[model samples]
Structures are given as C-alpha cells and as structure tokens.
Target: MIEYFDRGAIVTSSLCAEVMKKMRNEIRKKRQGKLEKVLLFHQDNASAHRSAIAVAAIRDAGFEILKHSPYSLSLAPSNFFLFPRLKENVKEQRFEDNAAVVAAVQEFLGAQDEEFFKKIILSYKKFILKVYYNKCDYVEK
Candidate 1:
C-alpha cells in the first residue's frame, strides 16, 4: 500500500501473474521504459518482502523498496479507499477488462478535487498519531 506508482496497478501472483506479465508487455509498448527508470516498492515486515526470492526479484528489477513507512493491519489505502471502490465498480459492471478498470479508476481520480485530496492527506498525520496511542494502550479489539 505504501508503494503506489503512477504506472502500475497492484496485483497478486497466483491469479494475476500472467495477466500482469501480458499487461507489462503492452505497457512497455505504450509507455516504453517510462516506468523502468525508477520504481517504488513499499512492503511491511511480511515474509514475502523479507524472503530471498522476493528480495531478489525486486533487486533484479531495480525497484527501490521504501521499507520504513509505518504499517498496520487496520490502516491501508486498499482497505480504506481502492478496494471498496473496485468492488462497487465491479458490481455495477459485472466484470471489466483491466484497461476498463483503469479507465474507471481514472474517472474516479478525475472526480476528486484537490481540496478533497488535501483533506485526506492532512488526516494522515492524525491517523498515524491515533494509532500510536491505540498501540501504546492495550485496548480490546
């Protein structure tokens, strides 16, 4: 969640590997190395990120992993923002191709104004601070 890039969408490997590979090939034709120069990876202390296999792939691909960002199960933009919207969108359309999904996302972003984004970004500080307190105290789930 921490490492979002303008050029790519997040995907899991089992179902999405071939799709991502095909998509990447097409994307290279369109953007042509635009995303190759620098890639940002954000991962938690998950074994996927720490594992030798995962680390090797990232290093080979030349993506810079931003490892220090604060992490929590209760807080992720996918949980908060993109996932719900994607669900809703899929419900409305049954299913769509990846490009169609991308278009829908673009429409979503276009619908958001700067002030709205600023408000959300501003709340990030408070969000993290609140979690700090929550963790310090042994509050029940």
Candidate 2:
C-alpha cells in the first residue's frame, strides 16, 4: 500500500508509529488474520524509524527489523531497484499537484506483479552475500 504524507510534512516519531500500525493492519488483512510467518521488516535508519515510539510500535506488531547500516545504498532495495524503475516510468512527466504525483506512483506500484517483488527479494539475498563477502563495503550495481 502506498501512503502519502502531506506536502512539507515531517515524518515524526508519532507518524512513523502510526504508519507501522497501519502497515501491520494491512498485512493482517491481506493474510486473512493468519500471520503464520514471522514478519521481517527492512527500512532505512531514519531518525523516526529508530525513535522509541516507532520501535515500540514495530515490536508491538511483532515485526523483526532487519539490521541496516547508515547511508548504505547497497542495503536499500528502493535505491537499486524500485526508484530507478519508477523514475524511468515517470521521467519527463509533469504533475499538476501532489495528488497527481501520488496517483502516478500508485499506478506504477500497482502495475508490478508478484514476480517483480519476488525477484527483488531474491536479489536482496545476493546483495547481502555480496556485502558480506566485501566486508560490508559498498556493493555497486
């Protein structure tokens, strides 16, 4: 699900907590209340993500956050995969408003199939191995 924040809105700890709750709820619904597998979440080390409130929310939702290094581009799937594809799709396009931009993003996300996401997850394993073999140094594409 794509959530859009208001223009110029700062992602505070409270907002992060709220978003985490919403994400958990969405996942529960999608799984039809049967969350059999452990939830492993990966996110950038933003201040809000590490804040007490957000951490509590994540724990409350029973999510195990994957360890992420600060400013590590290789660890961010969005940087190496999603965003570039999204940019290529929306490049040279002008949006009238924030809503339009959000719609475009939502459209792009909606167009991706399960295989697309599965491929990303599979690629993440390779990336992790590469990072490990390189002693945590940056792994270029």
Candidate 2 clash pair list:
none
Displacement of residue 79 (Cα, Å) in model 1 is 2.1
Q: Name the 10 consecutive residues with the lowest summed lDDT in model 1.
A: 12-21
Tens digit per residue, CA lDDT, model 1, 95-126: 34666667766777678689866766556446
Q: Candidate 2: where are CA atoms >4 Å away?
A: 132-138
For model 1 the TM-score comes to 0.45
Off by over 4 Å in 1: 1-46, 50-72, 85-91, 136-141
Model 2, span 1-141: residue lDDT tens = 668887999999999899889998999889996888889877777789889999899989889977675546557667776787899999999999999999999898899999988988788778777776777666676
The TM-score values for the models, in the order shown, are: 0.45, 0.86
Report lDDT (CA) for all predictions: 0.52, 0.82
lDDT of 1 at 84: 63
Query: What is the lDDT for 126 in model 1?
Result: 62
